[model samples]
Target: EAAAPRQSVVRRVAASSELVQNVAELAGIFSCLEEAFMVYSTRKAIAIDELMEGSRVSSVVEDVFYVLRKCARRAVATGDSDCACSVVNHVCAVLSQRLYVELEMRVGQIGRNKERTLDLTREAQYEGLMEALAEQWPMVEGSDDAVNTSSASALGASAMDLSTVSLGSAGPGGVDHSVLGDGSGGMSSTISAEAAFWCLSVNNVEAAADNVATVKATLEEEVRLVFDDELESAKLASCIAELDTVRNDFKKRLQTGMTKLCASLSPRLRSALGVMDGASAIVKYELTEAEFADNDGFNPFVHEFLGALERILAPHAAVLSPALFRTMVFKVAGYLAKQIK
Candidate 1:
């Protein structure tokens, strides 16, 4: 009876030791995976040349998920739910911390661009106004200091006058909205590059969502194959729910990014439409029959507005996916209809 009690104690010690060893092994696996994922993410972050070269989505979207699948399968093969759960949770952490943050930052850049674009537009308009003024009033022959004083006073007066003038107004001294349409004005390569990166960020979110679903399905299948017990599979299904949350988060970000992009285009669209308003105001419906006959039925404002819109949207259409492009078009159309109403 004493020997039986001693044997029981020995068995208990062996069980405890095995549990500790298993936990240590699992910890090692988790550490290795975490380190590997961090390295991969860092490498991809540094290698942004592909994004600059017009890759629609970051390669990390595919690469990280690819690694996740392999790691999840390996964890499942161990037949330990703790190991599998730890690894899956780590995957979610990596995605939330790394990929999601990167995407959010990229979308944030769009907001900054909106302000920068407006500032550039204002600067260009100021420059155009100064040029127009210099042409309209030639500088008088005088001392350099006198000329400077005269120029500064004229600019200050013009700036004050411009502050009250409507953007749509046009006359001999009025600001020319047409300048905004021409390539020589405010549009720059930097703006185009920012737009391209925004498109890529949006595409990356979409691609990442799809990849997450794919990886989840693959991991689930592997889990089922590895674990014969229904209860164990149920536990894994619960674990996989974490991935579903990540995918949903990605979808939400995608929608947010698209909405922001559409909103950003609104000011430009309104400016284009403003040209039509200005033209309509100056239309002379009481033209003589002979003058009407010579009108040639051309609406210069409509043509100008459309040309400006095409210039504004051409880069977006070229970069965005067809589906996304269609969504943007529909949204723009709805916005126009609302404005018309």
Candidate 2:
């Protein structure tokens, strides 16, 4: 009976999975959030690209800014403060640096669109916007964690009303996490475990957001593909099958792929886990749905998975993290790759 409250508390922690259910649930959430981000991001990029190409649509500016507003709110709501900050900063930069003045003079108002109201050409107006955003930044309530890349992607942004997310709310900061050690003889497994625990806790909001992004992207794209006239319905239906295939493939390959990544890194993981020899036995084959159902690889696989997790997070361990360069380009590529070609 005493364990009940403790169990709930455990359940509340970010990045800590008491069992398979927790793991699966977290993964599902993040996947959806990530996919939403993809849609938001893709559309935003496309619109801006069109504008930059000198395609004059007066409402384009309105739509573009409108999307930015949503992107900002989405970033915050989805638990990605970085994304929120990035979008806000980016808009500010664009308006400040570019010819908001020249555009107002030249582009003018083509047709009646609400965006025409935005005569952001003056330096004073631009300065005011920057100032207003600065003042409002604190109130925006972005995620507390910076390490979660997925959170950065989704951005929980909305138009002018970003009520869903707080500028700096407490999320996943105190959650429990599984930990492991790096192979330097200096650190203890206990220490390593505790560190990993902290890492996951801090990054919980972002990680969850990232997973949500993936899910949203896949489902939305799948739906679009289904409804799209350009796609042959019979071929379009295969999107679902492709999803299942990817799901099974990803699940089976999670630990092994991670292991491969870790193996490429310095201070190898297997050595630290004291499972260096099992690496071969560990990845005899890729996991399929049937194999996952058998409950066969949980123990060994979990170890390898966590090991990889540690490596993925290694570059982030610094007080000032410098991880995952060129992540945006990858997102763009991912977006194009998902299109029905």
Candidate 3:
């Protein structure tokens, strides 16, 4: 019932070019208006979770700054302060409301999550300010120089516009987009800065879950083959040392795999959430303990491994498409079965 006015405003902003142009004429007063909006929107702080919602806020904000900065530069290049002012003012009027509305939503959500302590609401409002600038700039698409093909496509950035802003070609405090990607798609030194850290973490968790079972099963087999019947003390000691070495190596490889996955997404997202770390601990096994125990030594190893794998993949369980998940589990199971030889 109360949303009608806001909806009407949204419609006006979306459809009425005259409204935007009129606001542009008042660009001289925009600074004051913007301050008021900022104060209103950021009356309360935001939570980390809301700020980090799927990393969209960061992307949106980045786009905003990139576009607005370009607009300012282009205006200066053309000696058209009025055009630039209009664009900036138009964005503020329209996007400021969006920010205010989103912040209102956040305020409502605050009571829902009682455990949240980190307030980033102010930061989010600042981000909205950036996004406001971006939303006003007319562009076919947005792009990020920091990520590889995906980010390139997602951000839809070019050397002259968005990239220019980040590189600070127009002003101070600009970001260097070159650090986003090397020709080799490695993102090189800038991978650590990507925000989509979850991609890397999730892939690592997936790889670990998939391979841990097979590695453990194979190592155990090697140990069994070497030990056979009861051996002499010297041989027993040698076998134990070999098994220990294998176990250590396996753990190292697991870490390496996880690191590699993170490195893979460095160019795309400047940072990542460690969600995969938590997700890896939530696996569910199909086999019961008694059932695993019934299979003797081999059964317990496979059962436990499967359980861990399931938990590691649990976070992805509800994804709209389960085809990939099913395939991964099938591949892991097939590998374990084949390794039995």
How close is each model in CA RMSD to the real structure? 13.0, 27.3, 31.2
lDDT of each: 0.58, 0.32, 0.33
Model 1: per-residue Cα lDDT over 1-341, one tens digit each: 78999988996887689787887686677757665775576446424313323345546566666666777777777787767777777777777777777667565555342333335543443233223322322221111111111221210111121112233323222223332232222221112334445566687788888888887888888887888868778888888888999999999998888887777666556655655345333335577887676556544434444445444554455456666766766777688779857
Best by TM-score: 1
In angstroms, the error of model 2 at 207 is 7.1
TM-scores, in order shown?
Answer: 0.62, 0.18, 0.19
Model 2, residue 16: displacement in angstroms? 58
Model 3 bad stretches (over 4 Å) = 1-57, 113-341
In model 2, the Cα lDDT at residue 234 comes to 35
> Model 1 compared with the native: what TM-score?
0.62
Q: For all candidates, what are the clash counts?
A: 0, 42, 21
What TM-score number comes out for model 3?
Answer: 0.19
